[model samples]
Target: QIRASVSDKDLDMYEKWNQDYGSWDIIEKKKKRVLIGAASVGIHHAIFSPSGDKVVTMFKDNEIAVWSFETFYCLYKISIDVGIEAFPSDQESIDVDITLPISQSKFQLMQQPLCFSSDGTLLVIVSIVDSSLFVWKWNEQSLHQQIDIPLFKEANGFNTPIKQAKFIGNTKLIGIVSSIGLFIIVDAETGKLVYKMPKTVLFDFVEFSKDGKFLSGVPSEDPKTIKLMNLKDFIKKKLLNYLRNFGEFPEKYRILIWRFLLRLPENRQPFQSLCDKGLHPAFEKINRKYPIKSYQMIKTLERVLSCLGHWSPLFAECDYFPSFVFPFIYAWPILQTFFASHFSSDEWAVLMDHIISEDPSFIYYLTVAYIRYHRETFLNMKTIQEFNKFHEQSIPTNVKMLLKSAKKIQTSTPTEIDIPKDIIEPFKPIPRSPSAYPLFSNYPVKIVHFQKKVRDKIRREELDFLQRKKVLHELSQLHQDIETDERKWIDYDNKVSTMMDEFWDKLIKDENDHQEKVSKINALETEQRTKLLKNIQKVRQNLVHQSDAFLNKQKDWEFKLDTARASLRETKIVGHEELQKLIDEENEILK
Candidate 1:
């Protein structure tokens, strides 16, 4: 049998009926019960629990009753107070046979006010009047949580009202859609917003899949088109967008973000193997060079450096090797607050790869920017010693500014330079000595001088490119302005013609009584057209003059760019084969 509830014409009486499932025949009719005394009072809506074991009915007067399905008895009753009056005291006991009346309505509802969780153990009620949410442990007849939804100021400077809300599957989370189509998910336990989607379109309806893996909505503008989204992918995209826009991570998530960005595998076995091998023989000079007070810190640094050396001999050959390990050690103490384990050798190796694999042109641009930033001070220095001292002091004081300026220079220019592809070759391990001792006290100075010469050439080329690029951009803008002006003139002429046609039609309709008025209108139209033509002519003349000037400037810049390109092709940085020969000569000298 199937059970159904019905209301009379006046809505003051209610009845429950039992009917045969397939035949549509009423098997039994329960007694008619007077639900409310006032004819204006009525039952608003009713819904069954998922199991159909219980029924919850809301009345027009802000009173709700929960009833048992088997006995048809009223189990509990509660009244919602929307700032009108205090809540009515609960009844100690209620007779199963009797029906009670409720007070008159106090506040209007925006939508269905309440919903049940999947298990029916909890209920969520949206209070439209106060903009609040109340979760109830309905089985226990007690309030579980109350959350006040604040109005966001950025939502068009008004309080976006909640249109509908429901529990997401069986989880302790609630998904809400506002009237303006802003969707948000909130953690029911913590009362914190976990995800929010901006209001880009108005939705007529929204629903989550049973498992809460997907959400589907019908846009109000196009009811036939349904928008379905995978919740997991949507959240990931939102996270990436936030990172791109804000470029900062919260302290708790920093390590995880760094690991993700660096693509760290965190392979434990290989890292452990390197650690077990102890310090490398090449770093035996660390005690003499950078003596430390903390024995544990020194030991940790040695272990980390040895792992790097085994991974790549190039790292062990660098003059300032300790500088790399010092940062990781300092970060280790802070990272310990979030993670229990110490930094691994695998992470260090990955960090080194990123630092060393950058394109050589990036470094050249950085050095060039650094020099130009202190160009005046260098030009003023008379002696080489003075220049060297100034260079050493300026680096420490202006390091941050120099980096910012270098990034600006790199990004602002077009990347069209034609350089040899072999410039970005991978690092090759140097042949080890028989004693496995460190090779040199400092890096080779000749290589540094060679790098400086290449940087100076690249800098001149970049300056020439920038000048040509600026002129080309200006020419493009000028062409667009001319087209825009012509479009505007055409639109103005069409508008004037339309107005004149409408005015002429009106005069024709009232011709007999307005002969003099038609003459005056014609004269006024003629004057307006003449003035418009003069303005159009003046604009055309100005545009023609501007075009002529820009064309000449464009030609000049193109010639300069051609000359720069020719010069770049003629100039030669050492070829790869020559560079290899130089490296071999240096190695033979060391041997």
Candidate 2:
């Protein structure tokens, strides 16, 4: 299905364009043109919903509006919140207040293709401005979830930004493409990453097959080849074949090849026309959007425009406009004059196109290669003018130098460890008894090893402190319970003793009264004395049993308290040792 934005207000659908030549000849009859929303806000991207009942379009104003496929009437208007006012807590926010909407240039580079699950239940939108993924429940009319794309640590010990993502309807997985050229698969429901291909490639806008068996996209190295591989079997043979011939190919062809590879729409105008009509509009849009533009910002933008003046007119309406220009402006801000002087307008366009679609690893490799090639020159440069002057050299020479130098960089092997004579002597003689062994027996022998071990020790100390803090808090609570139990036991004991004393005192008074009445009635006095004796005996037995049980319980609690105290003492000792070790290491380093 071919959906073309003919004008700002109209979108033309050419359903039978690919079927027959007769369909193209009678374009008016075959195509259906529908007016969509306002003409002022140009449509940036549009896609048919999975069900084919509705059309979703992203506008220049960053509004995502939905239109009925049959009627072309506006259904839903949702404004995309690309940039957040507050930064993520895990990250330290920049001092600059980047509250303004995302720039068209940036949005163009970072904007992801609109995607929907097969069931039409979920809609996913990726925002590069805030590095977040917004997923909507289309049928339910509510947001399903939104997740921030965190900087993922790469093999080179640096973080890479996520570039694009596509949904795999069959497997319930989302295919994520990173700027560094890695394919990542994540669970659609849970949002947890399930699989990440170690192999890296320079590709954009990946999509699943209609049957959901294979994934396909353009490769930067070979634009003509539509790279298709089974989702389960992502082999590197096809990608490696293209890489093998990458350096041997002519520089001019590389860009053109990339354009073909990306399947970017070919709507080229002359270089002069682009500068005259397009550059100023883009600049004016940028200027108006950002009210507080610094002189540096204006100057940087002008440099970009000046470079664009050399390239053929490619407007936002053109496919791959963002992918073509964004990378070059970003990667080499000061090398535009060099590029214009070296290559023709068409060649420059190709070069820009290649950069956006180029493998991220290769980009990193090229950067390292360039640094290696010009290390001495860069080191000798003193001022900004000197640096700019360096860029004035022919671009081909720099490019060639990097390509050649990168080949010469050999991987280094690990060095062998040499035992010190002083340390070797100590290990030569073994102690007869384990108890007589030196305290430094298991310690690091070499100074470098010792330093590393000491650093590790410090880190371990921090972890230990955190663990101890939690344990100590728990111990404090336990101690409070023990104190409360002890108090209860004391109170119980006092209550039992008071009751016994009161009973004994009353029994003794009654016995004295009965003795006085002994002469009056012998039989009644005997019976009363016997009952009092039996009661006294029963009370004594109960008191003895209660006292024994309380004592045993108290003993058990005391044992537990002792064990806790011992553990606390051990923790304190280890803490002191950690501090002492730090002090000793510092003193040794100073000496």
Candidate 3:
């Protein structure tokens, strides 16, 4: 994490120009500068902003100070993104490595922690309060915009808190969602869940391979190890050729055959390591023992990864290695062999689970089969597209009516206003006589009040939005809170928690010396100094008690609001039917 190329002494020149150590007048349209410093509250806690322009000694939530790169001036204070629901399409990547100072008072923590994207465009931050992620873009002079990615919200479903995230292969993000054991994956650009890694799951740190062919995660798990994962792009480009032409399948079905064809792989180190270890037995036989197509093409790609070191002993060992790798590379159809060898279907299912444990993608094919095998268990997995495909020759309507027969209602009044349905078929309209009508006394009156209450509902939603987003609203609340008795908590904590201890001790020493000078002190200066000292003292006192207060009260409202917000998204998309269901569920809950 220490990326400095210059010595601390040599870094000092750029330090002042970089970080606004003293009074700095930052103006627009000037040459940029760099700065470096440590966070305030804790010792050894450091933060260097983008370009090393200005480093905040301490973090402050809601309001953040930006230092000008050129004039070394501290710029604007800004708020964070809140109440947003969208993909974080942009990135702000900068080096924002932070370790907490020994003390909590280390300059105030800025809304927890945040990181920049590789391109220095997207900024990723987390809301520890709600356990959600927020991303923002860095525009010239200030923050561009923001997107909120609330990973999941289903009550029955599981979500892992994102401990750390790193971008891999430009498009994929190797993120650790440390909830279920440790979840790691190459999250694809399209947002479809991509490579889910087991060994990489426990990786606390990850680095790309030298040639960028693989993303490697150093072990954070027991049996301390390393996981070298190839990019899907290279795997498909180089390895798929071997899977396709080398393997054989008796089945004519392309999807089914493709699955079997992926198994034929060389058992030796160089070529076999290039394949998925747990390949299908049927396919492995066709490729390793007798390749249907010459491997002249793939050897070149393997050499490319080796820096074209074909003569290297490493390649030579891989070029000719053992052929015996149990179950696989054996010249036979394992599944058929098992059935003929007397294993029952139930026994076969149990056995296959272990055999395919190394290659989990086949689990999807099994899942689809399970869905078909048990028709009544799961209903929603079949999407509208699939339903339409079966009824393809003709399209089905999005709606259907459930009725054996239809019924009509007849409203009875003393007199009926018979407006015939057919105009031309009706008898020539008979002239009405006032006397025959005979309604001089009172007429049947029906009055109903109908109103559409829209604004009230919208107003109510706005209140809910504000109430639910306390983390996002912190910036707005800071100023008001600072003016209250609670501000004492921050002040007290910062005083003791921060380097203000030195200032405090100095003041205590000079209290009486300054008291003698109090005779010379103007009323305003005396009042100001006394007020500053008292607030500083108050901040330290509160730091002592605030943790208990924060812990007990933070989760009271924060715990469920994120779930509420996520459900709100579905209701918004699904419209009336789903919204109506939402209404019924709430009413039932309230009851």
lDDT by residue for model 3 (465-547), tens: 86778756785687677677567887878877667778888888899788777766777788989999999989988986897
Tens digit of per-residue lDDT, candidate 2, span 320-361: 333344334333332233244444444455344433344333
Each model's lDDT comes to 0.59, 0.55, 0.39
TM-score of each: 0.37, 0.31, 0.27
How many clashing pairs does model 2 include? 1
The reply for model 1, stretches above 4 Å from the true place, is 1-41, 50-52, 79-111, 152-160, 241-591
Superior by TM-score: candidate 1 or candidate 2 = 1
Return the top candidate by TM-score: 1
lDDT top scorer = 1
Candidate 3, residue 386: lDDT: 65
True-vs-predicted CA distance for residue 195, candidate 2, Å: 1.2
Q: Per-residue alpha-carbon lDDT of model 1 for 487-547, expressed as tens digits?
A: 9999999999999999998878778558778788899999999999999999999999999
Which should have the higher TM-score, number 1 or number 3?
1
Which lDDT value does model 1 have at 92? 19
Query: Cα RMSDs of all predictions?
Result: 51.2, 43.6, 55.1
Q: Which scores higher on TM-score, 2 or 3?
A: 2
RMSD of 2: 43.6
